[model samples]
Target chain A: MHRLALSAVLVLAALSAAADPLPSWKDGPAKQAITGFVTDVTKAGGKDFVPPAQRIAVFDNDGTLWIEQPMYTQLAFVLDRLKVLAPAHPEWTEQQPFKAALEGDLATLGAAGSEGLLQLVIATHSGMTSAEFETIALDWIGAARHPRFQQPYTQLIYQPMLELLEYLRGNGFKTFIVSGGGADFMRPWSETVYGIPPEQVIGSQIAQRFEVRDGVPVIVREPEVAFIDDQAGKPVGIQRHIGRRPILAFGNSDGDIQMLQWTTGAPGPSLGLILHHTDAEREYAYDRESHFGRLDKALALAPENGWVLVSMKDAWSHLFPPTQGSQPDE
Target chain B: MHRLALSAVLVLAALSAAADPLPSWKDGPAKQAITGFVTDVTKAGGKDFVPPAQRIAVFDNDGTLWIEQPMYTQLAFVLDRLKVLAPAHPEWTEQQPFKAALEGDLATLGAAGSEGLLQLVIATHSGMTSAEFETIALDWIGAARHPRFQQPYTQLIYQPMLELLEYLRGNGFKTFIVSGGGADFMRPWSETVYGIPPEQVIGSQIAQRFEVRDGVPVIVREPEVAFIDDQAGKPVGIQRHIGRRPILAFGNSDGDIQMLQWTTGAPGPSLGLILHHTDAEREYAYDRESHFGRLDKALALAPENGWVLVSMKDAWSHLFPPTQGSQPDE
Candidate 1:
């Protein structure tokens, strides 16, 4: 090739290589906010520059990273677990909570309250080693499909959020999941789905004890609540697990408001974002009065706190990753 | 200069830069074990090779990385805290545990048992925001000096261990501190002294709650024990915090046997090491009968478990990092 032609080719390659880090995100304030924060923090000798070691970013799993509509995927997993264990526990067919869960009676289960929910959770989530629980969760996540979408739950992860995770990591930020979901439940598949290892995931947990059974050391789960990583508990979980205040935090509900507050409230340049469900056609759009992920308080407080609310309709070009056999049969 | 001379200079520079990764480590079986394990796991296409993402290493902080003799540095901090708060709590001067702690009566404190120790820990370790606690711990760790060594506790870190931490990181391994000390206490100075960040430090914790106090979101520590990261709790803590089983584990006491067992018992390549406090001249020596950092059962099980016993006397050429004030005053 001629010298001029080769120079032009090199220039073109460089420009394309520097193309949008978040192509799934629309060109809007939400994308700009993320890019701008990353740029300012990474530029050496700049006023807002943060060291690579201190660049910690936390994300919420259910609503923000994946679909939380038609009830949480974990709740679905628990309901399935209830059915699987029903044969072993003969009394479950007659019990109030277990009967409701086993029969797919959403109304009764919803009205069962936190106490009933806790009982169901303990029944389904405890009495096994962490390794065993992880195996069970892995198999379920692989086989189970979303009721409404007719696709695996892992397939419903937001494409723009995945791109954002990759972009932030490329910019020297360590990304973590600070979720209200069961840590063990999310851990088994998070690395495969989101490129986030289990060690970087922080979430609610049950009591666990380390014991040697048949000369093998194992950590067994107990029927006691260790923590609840929702609402105000989000910040508490972040402190307990990460040990450092996060520089950036992303969430979608009032459960995440304190986490945003804790991150952006720090004395440096920080970013806090909320993923608003506004694309009813592509995904569920209920927010303020929603039964699952309520967002009224956080939405109202976002402006004053300098937390950006990312509109799904305007911000994202795609809803999820393309999956084979995801289309309904004709 | 001649091309041959320049080539020779370049070769010399390359060889010097690639010298020993652990210079402070003596030529012994302990050093050989570390190098051999790292080589086998990191070599691509090798039978025992591990991927970079799965290369996890965990180290116990107290006895393995730094001085824990005479008394734990945290215990010393708690005693100082007792003295500082004694004026406020006149009644504590008469209380059994508090009286024993405030008066520096080690014999009486020893007689107080686990219940008494718990009382002391709760009194000093809770009732503040995590931010406030971090500040207090930072100040205490900075100002406090080891009584026997007459140097800051940070300066008393094992030189060979620090080299090992750096070497592991250089080989694409993520290193973490799994300590029995308070997570909040170790987090303040861990990054500065050990090059391991706060997010990578896991330890015992007290109950914490997030609340909006005076129009600010704060995570406050409550006066209750949440989880103890010691003995059997070591494996449980590793499971809860870092969900993946580590490929390498290091410790000095029985508290870490479960962690080592959990790591080495995994399917693939793994390594476990214990730092024996054998250098009585450079550092205090105690094992089976010591009140602090007792190492009895773990030592006996090391051979069967394939865990290497790193003799501090033979494995390390130096004890602690050199500090500006560490030299004796002439």
Candidate 2:
């Protein structure tokens, strides 16, 4: 009887160990805040209980789910695409942004500003069918490596955020990506990488036209920008696509401030999270003064707005999954 | 032992009777085609078998799911709104379309054409928060009745389509409403009527702005047409919203022709269906030359495209659910 009791205890221990939903997250305030909020909202008949269908959670993609510095991975893709397409247009060699992109000069590219970057994006991203664009994006995403990390851009996805996504989904929360990047660029691999489906991804989009190409229907991307899903545009995009206000919102930069405010500001029991890139040794860490993913206003407003600031230096034990190649030499 | 055998036979018989997915659909080519296609795509190891995640079916809302005869239900809502708001604006009585709308003159209103209709839509639909619009829409849908049927517009939904939606859902298919009508107009009642949630309904939308009104974030509908999910716009809308191409498409008008062609023309086994309103006695009759849902081009091209045309008179055992009020006392 004593042996049987011991065996039972061991089995219970094994089951208890397996029950940790966010195994990648360290046992800290950030993890507690997440699990506690989920518990409070999910318990049946409770004051703060939200119905399973209404448990909407939105996450900013770049910097929140993955790295965004020294520049956005999409910006890197645009630069590379500009280089590949430069030979066809001799005018590109003389163009300000295209010349900057072709020469691999980050300083010149920065000087060219958003308008120059927009020009590069439009020239390289449009004039093709959606299916063709999907193929090009998939091929590029598969082949491209992060310059600093020396790993596939997809591999740079934060392990903690992935676990958080799975944790939320397991609790009946429908997870969505409300990103500032192009929706088409993200949809190709979001499902495989983050378990979020294509329809759940709301992002910036260029105009597209549906036409019959050789008697077959095709949606061709156009040069005009239909929507820019950054800052205030985040909430607008979310409203247009999801048609419902999210209860939980996550972000890492000032661009995501409006989205967080829109989500948690609504009259309800809600949670807002901001990931602070504070670990300089393990990852790029520049806030308030950074060129890309500047976290000034959001950092200032976090405390007053009741948003939880997650310190990457302390909260995370693992930056990325094991399969993402070894860290680069400093 | 003999009694046990009898019980087993009775159980099997009961199971077989309950297994019929489309009880409302009469045993005809339309019903057979639906069942056969579902079976082909659901059976494991079959060449055409589709995974549950990939099993998407898009349905056109206006004419395919409900009665759009005489006029569209949304148009009726807009006209009603115009009248309610007319008391505040005496100038509306002097306006061409508003005057015609107030006097219940469908002829003059129709003569005012798309531009006049657009003006009415923008005036009535915009200048409200999405939440406010939802409440107004819900209240209107619940109270307003069809003139001919004298039943709530929600009750006018075709019984066969309801069964088909449930049947597809049972077979692991995700059903979505891809309508030309306003998404906000449909979202308030879609879940209760069609079992499709707000997020699953993709439709025409005006621009929306996220603003903090009285220290609360609200998405106010703006007075500009952001997108029109009809004709060529259907495929573009589908690509923008769904991201994945649907395997099954259903519609009842020329507006859905491009959507159907896009679905069936993809390199895979697909099904495109058109619901023909041929039963003048039971319900609507005019189709090919009708003002509301013109089915001219689709009818001519159905045979060549292998699109199944469902004859309402022959294929549906019941026009609508029994609770919709018997035959409008005709």
Candidate 3:
């Protein structure tokens, strides 16, 4: 091609890149809805324009942002931690939840209910300095691989959702992770992976106390649950941390129903998006009947609530970002 | 004067205005220490230079930033609320702590100790939706006047500290309020008064439940103590909310000593400052023996800890920001 023609083509490509922020998102209702809402809320002097300060967008972490497939990454962390600390706590070998955890008894662990889960979480998560906990979490995240994807758990994060976060942030929306997972677990890596700083992430908390150990101040995690940021807890967590009703909220399961309701139920123009995991070929498709991230009630209420149900299969042109030595999901 | 001379003079004036970020802060050791620390940390390629993301500064709200004398503003709100709520609860008139609060009997209330204070806080601060509580707090903050200052509580904020807050932000520092005041109470007006957003304000909290009442979601304030962000609680709150230790901390009481220790004890260049209320003429003075914001242990440890003790009288050229109806303190 001639120099002028080549330059014109490059200009056109740059223009297209500038026009489409969510390059991984296909041209569909889901993409249209997101862009439309963003434009409506961002256009200066527009009727639906929301000021930058009030343009808070909340996202649920597990199935919404990354793969929560086989099990939550935090649960995996807890189980792994249980094994690591098993020799230290000989009592855990006999304890109901600990025994179930050690034996990889999912049925028994599930049967133990939330109480049993809490026991396991506290046993593994607590009795260490916050710094120590952070190092452990970081190490796990760096080394842990997704069972199905055979990639680092961080690498398994949805490419389209990452683009959505960037797109929203580009439009002056403050993106936050309001997750049910432990805040401590996510804080170590959220900044690097999601471009979300620790303060912007709100999650379930364990009690912590400040101590001066050997003339140095350290925050020691206590073996008690302080707050849970799931379902009804999501809105409460948002209120407690952000102190402002988010204009936009996205999540996957029944655990996010209340957050969706709270966001869409606001007086102003708001957007609630439910990520319907419909692409089983690329990612797990189980929703309504799934044990984890079950989407029964939220899926049922989506149409009536005016929430945009995003079909991953149709909406996302890509699932995970490209990885070295790994082929794209065919 | 010639046009060229006038232009030169104008340039010099503009440059002078640009050079002084903290005009309200007099030229003294306190001011020098603050500016020196900020310069050292913000200067690129310097050994003490901290990245913008790690440049976190925390400020204590009541005594550090504003007038906490003549009793805390929250305590006054509680006392006033007791009167308003007394008609509904006739038994409160006969109750020991309630009666003391209603009668303004400080001695009796003091005798009742922390338990009584908690009772008062729970009674006044809870039993309503978060929105309702916010409106109530905002209304009180709007109308309540500092008895000695004879100005609205928000206006009683230190002009020098406000300048410092702006200066820090201008130097790429994220300023946060870590106070013993209720988060809900401060969230309503913190942004307006201190330019610190609600999310950045970490404080004491009461239990709150998320409820969908009449198809509308609301966070209802529960009459139970959840978390206290005072003394040792300050560091815990920082870790829980911010997930990072601040490099700079400013406070005025023994209640802030732990926060100072936590901030300065970090393995990096850090600055901890204690504001001493030594301005008896411009503001209330009594420190070691004061009922509220008593600076005793922190005062003794400031020198040993390498914490800058900022003398309000000597360091601050001005106290409160200019008010429409009030004259400046002579």
| Number of the top-ranking candidate, with DockQ as the measure | 3
Candidate ordering by TM-score (highest first):
3, 2, 1
Clashing pairs in 2: none
- The segments of candidate 1 whose C-alpha lies over 4 angstroms from its true place after superposition are A1-17, A323-330, B1-17, B324-330
Can you give the TM-score per candidate against the true fold? 0.93, 0.94, 0.94
Q: Candidate 1 lDDT, tens digit per residue, A169-263?
A: 99999999999999999988888899999989999899998888898878899999988988788888888988888999999999999999999
Candidate 1 whole-model C-alpha lDDT, 0 to 1: 0.88
How do the residues A213-309 of candidate 2 rate in per-residue lDDT, one tens digit apiece?
Answer: 8988888999999999999899999888888889999999999989999998988789999999998888988889998889999999899888999
Model 3 chain B — which ten-residue stretch has the worst lDDT? B321-330
- Candidate 2: TM-score? 0.94
Each candidate structure's count of clashing pairs = 0, 0, 0
DockQ-superior candidate, 1 or 3? 3
Best lDDT among the predictions, by candidate number: 3
Q: Report how far off residue A258 is in candidate 1 (Å).
A: 1.2
Of the two candidates 2 and 3, the one with more favorable DockQ, higher being better, is 3
Q: Please give, for residues B1-330, the per-residue lDDT of candidate 1 as tens digits.
A: 454554454345336536888767888899999999999999999999999888999999999999999988899999999888789899997899999999899999999987898899999999888899899899888899889887888998987888899899999999999999998999888888889888889999999988878877788899999889987888888889988889999999998989999998888899999999987877888899999999999999999999999998888866776442332211
| DockQ for all models | 0.70, 0.67, 0.78
**Number of colliding residue pairs in model 2:** 0
Where is model 2 chain A poorest over a 10-residue stretch in terms of lDDT?
A321-330
